[model samples]
Target: MELTSGIRDFALTPDELSGFHARGYYGPFKVYEVDEMRRAWRGERLRLMDREYAVYRSEAAESGNTNIANYDRHLDSAYLADHITQRRITDRVTSVLGPDVLCWRTEFFPKYPGDEGTDWHQADTFANASGTPQILWPDGAEEFGGTITVWTAFTEANEETGCLQFIPGTHQSMFYDETKRMHYDPSSINRKEKDGVRRGFFGYDYRQLQKDPDWTPDESQAVSMVMRPGEAVMFWSTLMHASLPHAGNVPEARMGFAARYVPTSVRVYPDTEEIEEYGGRVSLERHGSVLVSGEEKYSHNRLVDRTTRGHRFVSN
Candidate 1:
């Protein structure tokens, strides 16, 4: 794939890097002009619905469930494939994850009018719902391993539209055990309230995985991330994060596309053949991690050089 020197831009400065380490998050950075993002989304959204080249082509994936159906569209949509490898996103990610980084996964999070907010939670192994370790790090590495998630706003994200909420510095510790089990009940969705807020973890209760049943996230420490269309934020996957419920004051739904990144040393979906979660299942037969930056020193994960439609991924 041809690459441009522009990919070298957007690296986090020293101060920004230190702040990210201290706060576990950074930026409502601008990735695209608002009109540019809106225009792109308008066209891409229509193209994405086709899904002929998507890796997870299954009945369950198209069943209207929010989970599997909204995953890895980058593998099919050229626009989304380019979005994931955008220098604005990958440069900042590599700033934190070192030179060699891989775009392991991507998912679309949409909050419709009156839909319940995402329950506050942190993920390490990412097995909270699937009961399978999604990412594994080698021994002698950090005590905990988590991917860097870059969440870009495709639509306006405001207080009424259910913007993301984060508790600073919470990435250093685990409040919920990923190994713990969380029951999935689709009927429970948008039907429960937690600490007086309407929230649910997709179809599961994230509270079920709490290390301490009585423990609660300190709302006093939480901050809302209000973003404009084309804005993006990067945070550690283990950061205590959630969102507010859409108040239905707006006509449009809030859409955030999250691209997950990890160093080449980390294994993506180690020993997994299929993903069964959120009451949906998809095979990994066509799965491949996109090396977004630097070299791939590890062979533990499958790598794809192009989108299923033959769009080349931008990489050095």
Candidate 2:
């Protein structure tokens, strides 16, 4: 869909871009016409039950009950895909990354009420098929090779419900070596106090870096991103961010969708023919379709694909 002529005039201002460049992330950007986007999200949620049920059964059968995974539950659904590619979203992404952008992948993160929060980590830590390291755009212009991550809030996100957080200005640096970092431990809860040190997700366990004489900042300071429904936050993939645990007793689970976009000029992994997130070696290009806008083409990835069926959950 084409954006309205006035849409280009709605792009972020220089001051706003500067804030993102200095802070590493920005927004609660007033993107979608709030009411309309909210309605669209609710419609998508109403259809989620059938999708969830089908996924549960399929996943259980494929991996056995012990190893079941729900990552692909939303793929192929028209409702969800439309929301991800909505014109309001694509325009903002194009403004940041320039005309040529490809969506590499999209994923839904449903943090159940009372569920533990995700580990603090940089998005770049997980490499896409494109082996290139994620870039940071301090200047918010095309010259920096910047990528845009648009995270849409499907449900109300706040501190009580495990909203996302980030360390301002942390994305400007290169990725920390994972070899020296700690592996993720799902069973044991991370109870470390934020001591003002700038660390990304799983930075705590990486002992060698922790012991570095130069690494003296406390690791406890992070800015949480609490947003209302229909509000979206955009961040560079290299930004150091993580979500807090859900402390609310809300009957419904917290749901959010993330879409990753990069310029088309970036080379995707060549070995993989098709993108498979579950268990196959797939390339980045295969994961998402390319979004061509004017002179630019952006890569579009689906974080959540809709399913044919839905599931119903009894509120506890």
List the RMSD of every prediction in angstroms: 2.4, 8.0
Instruction: Compare the candidates by TM-score and give the number of the best one.
Output: 1
Residue-wise C-alpha lDDT for candidate 2, range 1-316, written one tens digit per residue: 2222235654667897788789877787665665876788777666754533433344433453221133333344566556555666776666677665556456677777766666555544343222333333333443354356788787777887778888888787644443343443323344444343222232223333333435533346678888877788989876766777676578667787887777655544333443322233322321333343432232322222222233221110
Name model 1 segments beyond 4 Å from true: 1-7, 310-316
Model 2, which residues run further than 4 Å from truth?
Answer: 1-7, 32-38, 46-75, 128-146, 178-221, 273-286, 295-316
**Model 1, 1-316: lDDT tens per residue?**
2233344688999999999999999988999999999998998888877867777877888766648888888888778888888888888988898878888889999899999999999989899888899999888887648889999999999899999999999999998888888898999989999889999988898888988999989999999999999999999999999999999998899999999999888989999999989998899887788878887766687887746575333333
2 Cα displacement, candidate 2 (Å): 12
lDDT of 1 at 22: 95
TM-score of each: 0.95, 0.68
lDDT of candidates 1 onward, in order:
0.88, 0.54
